[model samples]
Target: MLAKAFYPTEYKKQKENSWIRVCVRFLLLITLGVPSNTLGSFQITDDISKLSVLKQNIPRDYNISVSYVPKELAGMCWVKLNIYYLEESLNELAKKFGNVSSNKNDIKILIDMLQDMRLPLGHLDPIMYDFECHFRNEQWQTEQYFDYVKDLLKAAEDNISDDCDPPPCPTTLPTGKGFDVI
Candidate 1:
């Protein structure tokens, strides 16, 4: 019975190095003492606050302004309004007035907005997208949601160490090594 209970099929399958990596990440998280939920807090706040600024900048009657949208329905319109906000910010920066120096503040805000936009392009998207699909389904399943949460945890763990390095280009080869065929 003990041998049967300890069988490989009954155990969680993971790469040999995976537990070491998990321990290191777990220790790193503990050492930092930062709650996992707060990982994207700053970026999320920056994204939300930009809406108010964009709302204030655009005229109330402006066609693309989301100011008129109800707060309850905001999620439905968020992505569209975010794109419009970027465009409107760029347009504002492009214009020059008699007195005001073409709002450097707007340019800074735009840069932050672009960074916020790029944040979602990180590796967590596929897991989040899967979660989204499950969330949208008419049938609710607790087991699936639990699995989604686990996947999300793993994705967050995987992404926690990402330093956001730029991709290799024709001009730049990766720094590590060249393979030698035996």
Candidate 2:
């Protein structure tokens, strides 16, 4: 007589099983302590940590020559390496999310994390300035050296733009920039 009587027992069993599956999934999520809303943030945080590690591994004594690449370039190189890793991580996140622009809040969180990480590197500004001055004067040694310097300069510019307001900037190296070769 009731609507329930119209459905077969098999249909009712399937409905109950689906509800059980949903409940199990919800419980698992809660037990894992990963709130659904903060999952993206956790992924972003993990990526930032990995970037920090990569930045730390850059050789502090990295120098080409006393006359060409100064010892100060080591710090600048670290900054460049950081930017490159950050860009790669962001790209991977973008791919995972598929159209990250729509998720403005996630983008903001990522940018905030990046800015915080870069805060300590602010002290390197004087070194960067000296590099820029030398760059403008064509003081670098070879064509490869000049391209490498340009790549570093491009990375620096990308870093500055990323620290600005919303909409994370694109990281573009100069034409001949080699990956990790510097």
Candidate 3:
């Protein structure tokens, strides 16, 4: 009754009609390319300095620093860092939800994706090695390095699944006071 008062039949119909019109127009615009003016301006550049500036914009946490990475290594380091963070997040998610049968397949897909990514990430290790050996010793800050490695190791240990038992799936349908029949 209160919903009817707030949104009368005529108003609801008009609102729904407007929404449908919007969706149709959007679909039409997609089917027919949008006007050039709507896209605004875009430019491609091979400028190295501009690349460095763009690289600076990549997000970072306290544990990772890209500011001191050499220009040649900046891009590879960024990729490695992103993969590391993604693998960490997925592992955490797996630890939390992978026991659920429904989530196992999705987690496996993510793990497979990570494995694929590790190929490219492995190729970039020479860049990382150069950065660590040649550039890092001089430019890299070490104050938090030990703490960061320690935390990373601890997280790795926590995410280890070998020690944990998978949750058991029920063969029979559940029956209890709280269970409802469909």
Cα-based TM-score, every candidate: 0.25, 0.25, 0.27
lDDT of 1 at 180: 14
How does model 1 fare in lDDT? 0.37
Q: How many clashes show up in model 1? A: 0
How many clashes in each candidate?
Answer: 0, 0, 0
lDDT of each: 0.37, 0.40, 0.39
- Listed per candidate, the RMSD to the true structure in angstroms reads 22.4, 15.5, 23.5
Candidates 2 and 3 compared by lDDT, better number? 2
The best candidate in terms of TM-score: 3
Which residue ranges in model 2 land beyond 4 Å of their true spot? 1-44, 47-76, 80-101, 133-182
TM-score, predicted candidate 2 vs. hidden true structure: 0.25
Candidate 2, after superposition: displacement of residue 142 in Å?
Answer: 30
Model 1 misplaced stretches (Cα beyond 4 Å): 1-42, 65-107, 119-182
For candidate 2, the per-residue lDDT at 133 reads: 23
Give the alpha carbon lDDT tens digit for every residue of 126-179 in model 1: 433322211111211333322332332233334433332222222432232221
Query: Which pairs clash in model 1?
Result: none
